[model samples]
Target chain A: MESNRRKFLKVAGISALGIAGAKPVLNAFASEQEEEAQHADVEIRKNEKALTARQWAMVIDTRKLQSEEDLKPIIEACHKTHNVPDVMDTENAEYDEDNQRHVIKWIWEEEYKHAFPTKSTEFLDDRLKNLPFLVLCNHCENPPCVRVCPTKATFKREDGIVLMDFHRCIGCRFCMAACPYGSRSFNFRDPREFIKDEDRNPEFPTRMKGVVEKCNFCAERLAVGKQPACVEASNGAIAFGDLYDPESEVRQLLKSNYTIRRKQGLGTGPAIYYIV
Target chain B: MLELTVKGSKKYFGWMALVLGVIGIGFCVYVWQLISGLQITGMSRDVSWGFYIAQLTFLVGVAASAVMLVIPHYLHNYKAFGRITILGEFLAIASVTMCLLFVIVDLGQPMRLFNVILHPTPGSVLFWDMVVLNGYLFLNLIIGWNVLEAERNQVPPPGWVKPLIYLSVPWAVSIHTVTAFLYCGLPGRGYWLTAILAPRFLSSAFAAGPSLLVLLCLLIRKISKFDPGKEQIQSLAKIITYAIILNVFFFFCELFVVFYSQIPEHMDHFKYLFTGLHGHGVLVPWMWASLGLMIFSIIMLVIPSVRKNETTLAIACIAVFAGTWIDKGMGMISGGFVPNPLHHVNEYVPTVPELVITIGVYGIGVLILTALFKMAISIKEEVAA
Candidate 1:
């Protein structure tokens, strides 16, 4: 890492000197550097089955999700795969005034009343009234988290995943404050302490204390040519695909069924949609 | 100039020792927080920011209040303000110092704070806040020290400082406005989404900052050979009165929009803060106390006879300072977060260590203010002789 930074500095300095000598040479050098970065990314993702997308999105069909029981495995699969800390289960976690306040979840269930607060009403259909909605990062088309992050630690990927570069995060929680969905969680304590060794995913990295974290739409799984853990776990209750692709599952679901996005008035363009 | 600070009365040295002692305790507690992470604070995932950020937000206003003196003295050539303007600048230096410390302590990764600079995120409001705050600090340090040093040397202040003094007028407003942008621009947070947040922040800042200056001037009068002058105090009292009135007026306007429209997304936060949303009303009493104090102070300052009287004016100043602290510093942050984006009420109150560390930061600020005031008073005394 240190040598890479030194090399970058050297390249930047040479470019600075090159600018004084020839503009054409500077432009060529910049393009060459960009090609090298793309080459490195290709080398890292050697997995041929890697799922590619123009814009990733999800569809949660309430008709498929018959009961609260149907939601458990979907949540469990994502949490287990991502090494999300079981916040309330920790012994002596009583340090918090309300443990749920400190609870961290990448994807979890929120009641319809709370999930679609702007849209919820008291006299809704009894089934809709008590229904649970799956909530996660909207992976917004215009992400406020990305906009407000001073360190650019929480950022939107080209494929529409709002991912965290944990190593670079300053944990200022500005992103948390900026997130309108309540999707982000700050690690108030060492998250590693809460995850059991048996439940911990060796393939996924656990977050340190103090940094903010949230659902990355399983970008890691996608890079390895696999569907997100929740998509596989939800028994078709959840559909995931590229939103820009008309032939994709999410696009098909949206076209056939009526769906609602949370806080649509805010114009964040949430990729996650609820099929009411 | 340095010697002037070191040479002080028994009372001054004793006061300095007391400040140092508080800082010592605070530093040790802060170390504990550094080791333990933010779990030591009342903040949670829901209320991501708490006491530390609140204090930073409040002190920015205090730091910006130096402009109240600058505008009148430099722009209008108000001779009465000439005596007290240096004190205002020095107070800014101390307040900005505390503001910086609060940001440091609030960070989950303090070591990586420079990432804001290293990454150079011109897009982030927080990045701009950092730029404006540090710039304001250097501006005051340079302008205050140079102007004072020039006075001590019995020569004219360098011409370069004149432009910077003029630059500081708008720069001061920028610091608070940029700080307001950190909140007002966020997507879902209803309490902070108002367009008037920046103006409200400014009005409260102008009121609270000048009120603090009034108290500091009063303290200087009681202890020092050089008085900050009654005319200057009366002039500052007038500034506070007008600012506080404007601040309270802006708040009522916000209340009207929130309640009259009955938009639960917006009104729920106000209900949570002032009237307790869902059996969680920890901040309710404190919010009322703040409103009560502000109204009482406004009434006192509004009466000309009372505003002219130093004792009553001093009481009003205290009320303004306390009221604004509770309203802006405490209520604004917690209320914005309490009804978390999911509309859940997870109340936050500063933990013991958090409050102590806060007191420690204030102690350090007081020590800085004390030193700066002593040196300024000493220089003024020399000039008087």
Candidate 2:
């Protein structure tokens, strides 16, 4: 056993030397275009016609979502298209004093006061005071969840969308702690077991037990030149566009309205803005 | 040398058998958990981590406590610690083994654990924790085994081991620090975001680890012909006294900052822990009990007359151990999750199977410690004869 360990260490040491030897040679042959592209502030789109930017962002118009009924279609569309599991049985499941349960959710509604606990005040208008605000992953430019993942299971794409690679997740839940937004969910059991057969989207793959998952902002949809399921269903309530593009609807909306973000004081640079 | 464990007193064999029995049961329960998933545990979407992670956090301190002995014996040239230093290292080995086990059992995908190493993320604190913890375990194993071998042979330890021994000291500090970073560096959890978390962890670990060691030393003296010596025990008590005092002071410093600021994000967690926040206070009793024990232990330890008596000292050390165990293991992790991202207080209670698994892991740690100490003590007895 000792000799085997020694042999492994020797091989590892030689590999380290090989990598160190190859690094400078690899760097020396870098193309001028590639170097200039690396320095470019804007992302060079694969297809110039596609709505691509260095950072993709979302702007939610909570005013348009006047009632709980207004949110159902958007949420249902996202959940159905993404094959998100419906494990929560709120009526039947035993709940503690905190009303917590073993559940999976990619997006949901929360009271404005609770959703913006640090920012909201008690003396707001009665309609706004009792408003049910939509909440989901902020897709922060500096996502803490991505930073804390041991397996690099969750990572931020160059377009600023946080992506979850379900296969790589070890289900350690470190990202759960790191994400202040509480956007991530772990599949405690086989999610497929909880999902209804008719509701399941055969087009999308379901996750297995023991992996953390969260909203990917429908990066797959964006790849295929389709709007996010929620955005398509919101009927102008939600605007999905590039934050880096001056002509984008989201950028225009942000310019015209005062928008707030969840825990912006932490300097995570959250991409999801709320037009409260 | 491996056979040394086989020949033991009937009581020793009985104890080993009992621990093995519990481990057998625990293994069965762990298999159930693996098949059914973490759904059986009380962990919810809000409180993602529960009892297992808490135990992992606490045992990391116990593992890092070997440095308490290593620092004095090697750096300060304290000769009295030479006899008990191996005991400390062996304890660390056992503690780390349990830490690793707790991590594995807590994972949703225990099979995918190597994905951590396979990916080798420098960005993640969990990755660093894996690195430092595995590194510390091996360091202690190599140092403890070689040093004991040299002692048994009645020769000086090999020259290479001296550097490794020195390396283990800072390496011990790194383990707890990385563990603290796992919580403190998170953006959302106001409770663990304090700058003092790493130092607080180290101080509390210094107190808790040495306290456990001193208790173990007393136990060894009672059970075996070898005595770790009164001087070594007393020195360890002194270390615990100063460390526990500093640990308590750091806790108050944290309290002051949170209360004075009056920020709900920061203050809400303390409110939940010390007092019920928004009518949820499941952990209040445990938190207060921890505080009471810590105060009582510090009072007893500070008074020389009380501390000098071995019986009183043992009781005080037990208090310190239990107090810090509840604080670091239960309150710290759970409190961070309460008043979760949505400003709701979620409570976590370990299920029966979860408790059994936890006890089983502790049994494994004890079994490992017993075997290592059995080997060491037999060698010491032979050397003395």
- TM-score per candidate, chains pooled: 0.93, 0.92
Provide the TM-score of chain B versus the true chain B for each model in turn. 0.99, 0.99
The regions of model 2 sitting more than 4 angstroms off are A1-51, A89-100
DockQ of every candidate:
0.64, 0.69
Pick by TM-score: which candidate is best?
Answer: 1
Q: Which residue pairs collide in model 2, if any?
A: none
Per-residue lDDT of candidate 1, residues B1-385 (tens digit): 6678999889889999999999999999999988878888889888999999999999999999999999999999998998889999999999999999999999998888877866778899999999999999999999999899888878989999999999999999999999999999998999999999999999999999999999988888888889999999999999999999999999999999989999888998999889998899999999999999999999999999999999999999999999999997799998899898888888888889999999999999999999998999999999989
For residues B280-323, write the lDDT of model 2, one tens digit per residue: 99989999999888889999999998888889999999999999
Q: Using DockQ as the measure, which candidate wins? A: 2
Instruction: For each candidate in the order shown, give its overall lDDT on alpha carbons.
Output: 0.91, 0.89
Candidate 1 Cα outliers beyond 4 Å, as residue runs: A1-46, A93-98
> Model 2: which docking level applies?
medium
